[model samples]
Target: MLHPEIQAKARAELEGVIGLDDNGHIPRLPDFEDRPKTPYLEYILLETTRWAPLSPLGVPHASTNADEYKGYYIPAGATVFANAYAMSRDERYYSSPEEFNPDRYIPVSEGGRGEPHPEGPFGFGRRVCPGQHLAMAGVWICIATLLATMELKCPVDEEGKELRPTVGFSDGLSGVPDAFGCRMVVREEAMELLGL
Candidate 1:
């Protein structure tokens, strides 16, 4: 809802892939096999993780041996937290870190910036989230499904102006965005396809 253009682009890809029935209704839901055909979806997911990491401070790790960086010294055992949030917004990589654009992941040959996929969202090294694969798959399908059928956008006020949300996130170990209002109207075509 915060980014309607992104949603529209994703939906367009889905529509091209899924197409419509002879009756001019959606024919089927997106499947795993659509991965290749819907590359934009992957970019969107990647941008989502990079834009707003779920774990701002990734899972803490304990050093088995002493380590030092610069002039700082560490004991044999110390707890360390990777600042995933800061890494996400690093200008060195992302052109406009504040903007929620997914096209950055596309390769230079594909006319995109070819930015590298982000790291540290799941974790670092061997301590990486064990279920990262499952989590990503689940998230991808959920996002694809929502975009396929819904018109997600800001709600209009009495004056018919969009009520752009004041984007905010919850505090703590989690980086869940604060709740915001938006419309999620099921596309008329989708409803007709579903026989609703």
Candidate 2:
């Protein structure tokens, strides 16, 4: 993984929630039942969304009435785009806007210094993505399960040098990561947990 510390922290959290059984293996996979107690995992998911939001420019909305913002006048019915990307990395809200730090979402009581706020990668207002909740839930479950059962690392070339992926996204309405290479190895305990 690019950030081993964060991955280790998440795995540690998983261990605390669904610890080993008599055979010294993780007894079960993470589920909705464990979601409430896995705050750190939640932070990781949130950070993933913020770091590379799928939709940089949210769905366009038309102004119902004429309005003025920062000395700019907008006629009625003018289409307005919410730059979700800018908001996600706004220096005013995030301390290190460019860094991918999940701890930013962790509460102060939990030893993290992030300020609590309602902003998310999802679009805002009444027009916000209707499936945001469902999408987040799905992403959370997938990420948690994967991190619990495998190790992700940058791939290596035939010469044995590690391939460091360039952190860039394709230009489009949606900001998708450019082609990259990585390696995923199943954890030894994963098979046992899977009853394989």
Candidate 3:
């Protein structure tokens, strides 16, 4: 909902992939099988993780031995934390870092202005979350299904002015959107497809 254009593009991809029935209803639900074929959806999921990582400060790591790098010294057994959030928005890696633009992850040859982002959302190295693959898969499926089935929009007030909630997050070990209002109306085709 924060980005209507991205949502529309995703919806178009879903319609192209899953297609519609003779009655103009979606023929079937998106599944894991469709993941590889939906590159845009993949970018959406990746951008989501990069835009707001669940663990801003990745799981801390302790150096097993003393080390020196870039003229900096590290003591043995020193606790170190990887700031994944900072890296995600680094200007060197991303243009318009503040904007949640999925096109940044798309290939330049495909009309997108940027290239695929380097991996970092899930911590680096062997210590990275073991469930990273499963997590991404789940997210992809959920996003794809949602885009294919519903229309997400920010709620409006009685005066018809759009009531966009302040984009804020909670303070804690994890970061998630603060309370906000959005309307998830099932698409007409989707409702019919679900026989509702």
Candidate 4:
């Protein structure tokens, strides 16, 4: 069940925009255009993707033939793995790289690169994720609705260690956070007209 406290925060944000709480029965479901106004949710979506990247190591690529990349000779049939996780955490690309803060994606200007480091590690050139648009849309919608009407909070146990998420993962294809518990709350009024 969603936690009430988190819900309150989301609801507050919603009310600030939507002005009513009809049990989340808003005028319409969220969409892409709502992104600018619902910027926080966008950050949440990107952060979620960064936090638990779909693939720790992105799709593997093989060198088709002998070629010189930079100064090194890469022979044919060489296997390569792109570390999305590492890129996301690179200090050159991110500030406070180890923290789980999601505000990195929020744009600093009208047409500028936003926070959360815009340099994507989704694979290079043609090998990039084929479903990038679909994936982003799914993530955006899910996050939008959540931020629109729900809150997420970390849960603590009796010892109060703040239960760190598992560092290692089983999937050789990707790196993912280990199992951890957190509280999710539904906000009473976290939606708005948006005028989109």
Candidate 5:
């Protein structure tokens, strides 16, 4: 809701793939195989994770062998927590770390920066989240369906002004955002497809 431009761009990408009928009716919602045609969808997913990581402090990891590199003392066994939030916002890697821009994830060959995805969000090495792939697939499908069927907008007041929700997050292992109101209006094409 906060980023209509991004949504519109993604919608355009979808239309280019799925297309519309002569009466401008939606043919059908997108499927998993259409993922490649709409690369922006992946970018949006990546941007969401990069902007606000689910787990700010990644799962605690134990150091098998400790050593001093930055002049710190060495320890045999140590508990280390990677700061994913900090890593995502590193200015050296991100052009404007604070901005929620999805284009950063595009590959360099495609004229994008080819920036690396935030690794700490999932985890490192053999300890990575097992359901990461499934989670991405499910979320992508849900998002694509919604984008195809409806237009997401912020809830508005009677005064004709947008009621921007206070962006607050629950602090914990997973920093889930607090409730925010949005208005999802069914698209004209989708309504027509449903024989409305």
Candidate 6:
């Protein structure tokens, strides 16, 4: 379950841009048309995906049969993987990859002028993520609603230092970040808007 604070925050943001049809009644949920009005929401999606990739190493690409290309011999059943983590962190692609800077996605132009390569996270070719649009839209809505109302705070230890959360991962066919913790705070007005 989401922290109450987080839920409240999302409600607040949703109420604002969702707007009223002049009848004092809540309108339908946000849509793409409302995207221009809520840029930060989209940034949240990009940041989340970048911070925790769907696949640390993208789906493996394999050769169907033995062949030679670029003077390299290919054997059938050869295991391959595209490094999603490296691609995301490439100095050529992102500036200050270590820092969590959502501003990197602020640009609306094609490929995010700031990104080293003009490509979004879904990837390329016939093997690209089939659900890119659906995933992006889902993330966009969730983030937009969340930021609209709540404030996220990092948990701190007794030493008065913010918790340094780490992504625990295992070596295997799939890589996933381990569990971590954080704090959430929701303001009063935000909750009222969300109707929570």
Best by TM-score: 3
Candidate 5 residue pairs that clash: none
TM-score of each: 0.93, 0.92, 0.95, 0.68, 0.91, 0.68
What is the per-residue lDDT of model 2 for residues 1-196, given as tens digits with 9 covering 90 to 100? Answer: 7897999899989889999777767888899889998988888877877778887777778999999999999999999987878888888778887898888887777777774443546778776778988998998889889888998989999998988888999877788788889899888778787666
- Model 1 per-residue lDDT at 85: 85
Q: How close to the true structure is residue 132 of candidate 2, measured as C-alpha lDDT? A: 88
Which candidate ranks first by lDDT, i.e. highest? 5
Q: Between which residue pairs do clashes occur in model 1?
A: none
* Better candidate by lDDT, 3 or 5: 5
After superposition, candidate 4 runs with Cα above 4 Å error = 1-29, 108-116, 156-171, 190-196
lDDT of 6 by residue, 1-196 (tens): 1233434444555666786545454545466677776654555556656755767777778878888868988899897666777777877767887665656775647446454322435666887879888888877766665555446666789987877676566665466667877776664445555676
Against the unseen true structure, what C-alpha lDDT does each candidate score? 0.86, 0.83, 0.84, 0.61, 0.88, 0.63
The residue-by-residue lDDT of candidate 5 on 1-196, one tens digit each, is: 7889999999989988999989898898899989988899899999888889899988877778977858976576787878899999998998898898998988999999988877777877799899989988998999999999999998999997999777778988899899899899998989977677
| 10 residues in a row with least lDDT, candidate 5 | 72-81
What's the distance in Å from true for residue 138, model 4? 0.9
List, residue by residue over 1-196, the lDDT tens digit for candidate 1. 8777888888889989999888767788788887779889999989988988999988778888998978788777798889988898999999899898999998999888999898989998888999999998898888888887778889899998999899888878898887888888888778975567
Stretches of candidate 1 off by over 4 Å are none
**TM-score: model 4 vs. ground truth:** 0.68
Candidate 3 wrongly placed segments (more than 4 Å): none
Q: Please count the clashing residue pairs in each candidate, in the order shown.
A: 0, 0, 0, 18, 0, 4
CA error at residue 34 for candidate 5, angstroms: 0.4
Task: Output the lDDT of residue 186, model 5.
Answer: 90
Error of 4 at 38 (Å): 2.1
Better of 5 and 6 by lDDT: 5
